[model samples]
Target: MFDKAFQRVNTFEDFRTELVEGKENRAGEELIQESRKKQKVDDDKETTELKQCLEIIPDEEEVTIDAIPLAVKSPRIVDWKIHKEGTKSYYQIIRADRKSQMYMIFSHMLKSFEREHLEDLYKLVKARYGSTRPVESMDYLLWNDMKIMFELHVEDEVWKLQQGYKVLEWKLYDSCGVHSLMMQSMQIYMLVEKKYPLTPPTLSMMLERSFKLIMKVKWLISCVN
Candidate 1:
């Protein structure tokens, strides 16, 4: 049971002492030269290992097929907001230059789409812009199908109609009677024209405004009669 078949393993201090003893036994010039060469090889290996470790850099966050920005303008959209409930991924986008105008687009049918599609889009954007920066926001969540929520800068176009209503308001103040009532109705018609393809709620609001103006005009006519 107590058989001393093998020598005990070298401790750190014991190993260093043995190396020193071995060096002392050798010819000083040749042994010193050989030890220096071995040390240099080990130093080179360590430097290489450190360089390799430093070369490994961590990756950053990337764009995917879940969200993408678009170049369009609409009043309905609230700029920079992601509308998730109605569609899988709906975004109220605006051009980088003009935040006053905004638009909306749906990304893909499924909440989770293929990553390969995103790669394709990335390539396409890179090719077109010579860099992904132009479409950095636009191309990320892009899908084959896209629907423009409203015409480009519809808000700016609506301003013209607003100017017309202002003019009508000025005329109403100047002439209070049948003339003013008719002017109010004219402005209401213009409002209807300005907002064509109106939703049911919008149409109802327009009709109500028009109806009230007509009632006022009829009341004026009856007072004269």
Candidate 2:
């Protein structure tokens, strides 16, 4: 092939002269063809790599509470009882009998507290929301109960601190209050349970509100204690 790339010389002297004239033409078009073939192979390899990259995809996994087995996921649920209050149906949780006595004691304490301070709490709520409307409902009762619980928690924490307990070192931080943090967490949990199909804006608002409430409660508890 290389020999065909050039014309044949007549004699040895002529061949030597041709060699001298074609010194710059060693390998001739064969080298150019080989280079083009190599370039094409390299371009094809690069194209294959680009196609593989374009075809690559990432795998994603989604998880939901319903996807998990009930027995294994939530073993604490003993039973549920439905109570019809007028038109609304409320589900009452009934846990193990081992907790029956404790539940009874807690209920008794709540009833006693309400009995003693119901009038006072009513007055406070009335002052907060004007005396034009009467506050005599579940929300009023819950608000008073939460306040009592908050006070009790704060007092207990203060006593613990006085006794040289290092509990507050971690519990009473700048951003969170130990007294009402649990209640706020429970509120958030309940909110999530009641509002599962929440929009991004709603979820964001709830989180911001909950965080501010928690921080405010913590600051108030610290000031009072």
Candidate 3:
């Protein structure tokens, strides 16, 4: 009789142990599932933000060089030479077409620095325009931004020159002329670089190219970071 009593007690204790272990295992599984769901939600949010940040207008029409009207009087052949002023070196292309008129300036610098400058410009645009695409009228704003960027580049070049450092790969150009003539000259300059020798592009085209370049730089930076 005592042996039977002891065996019944032992069976009850074993059953309790098994029940406790089963509950613990279920709790652990629930925690793991919850963690996986949270992780997936976080990932989805990041992807959505990235997509919004990189949004671009589709099939936007561009004004080609051929569309621009030629100047009534051909511009005088301007002389270009490397100029050094107070630790800054740049190509100075004088516009002899008009006396005392603004001439074109070209500076060569490191491609990496150029990319960073473009990224900075992208940030400025995003801050002003948010996720909305800029309108045609807003092209002037972009041009202004580019002008500021070039000015900053000039300062940077001066600093680098002072440090006895010289870099090259990317070219920066600034000029003033009749809109059509300016566009033509710019297009010619770009084409000459590529050895294609084609026509010039409009102000809008130049802005569009700058926008695309900024986008590319931003995308590359995101990948690296």
TM-score for each predicted model, relative to the true structure: 0.18, 0.23, 0.25
In candidate 1, what residue range of length 10 has the lowest lDDT sum? 173-182
Lowest lDDT sum, 10 consecutive residues, model 3, at: 176-185
- Residue 41 in model 1: shift from native, Å? 99
Superposition error at 85 for model 3 (Å): 30
Rate residue 94 of model 2 by lDDT.
40
Write the residue-wise lDDT of candidate 3 on 1-225 in tens digits.
999999988876577888899999999999999999999999999999999899555677664455545654334433433455675545333334633222223222112123333344345545655645456433333433444343334342222332322221223432221011122213112211222211233334556666877999999999999
Q: By TM-score, rank the candidates, best first.
A: 3, 2, 1
Output the lDDT of residue 153, model 2: 40
Q: Select the stronger candidate by TM-score from 1 and 2.
A: 2
Clash pairs (backbone) in predicted model 2: none
Q: Which stretches of candidate 2 lie over 4 Å from their true place?
A: 1-13, 20-26, 56-225
**With candidate 3 superimposed using the best TM-score fit, by how many Å does residue 90's alpha carbon deviate from the native?**
23
Residue-level lDDT of model 2, residues 1-225, one tens digit each, is 556544333222656878766764766667888899999999999999999888544557553445656443212324333445685544343433422112221233232232223333334444554524325444344444434443334343322333322111112211111112122113211111122233354445546666877899999999999
Q: With candidate 3 superimposed using the best TM-score fit, by how many Å does residue 12's alpha carbon deviate from the native?
A: 7.1
Error of 3 at 37 (Å): 0.9
After superposition, candidate 3 runs with Cα above 4 Å error: 1-13, 56-225
- For TM-score, the strongest prediction is 3
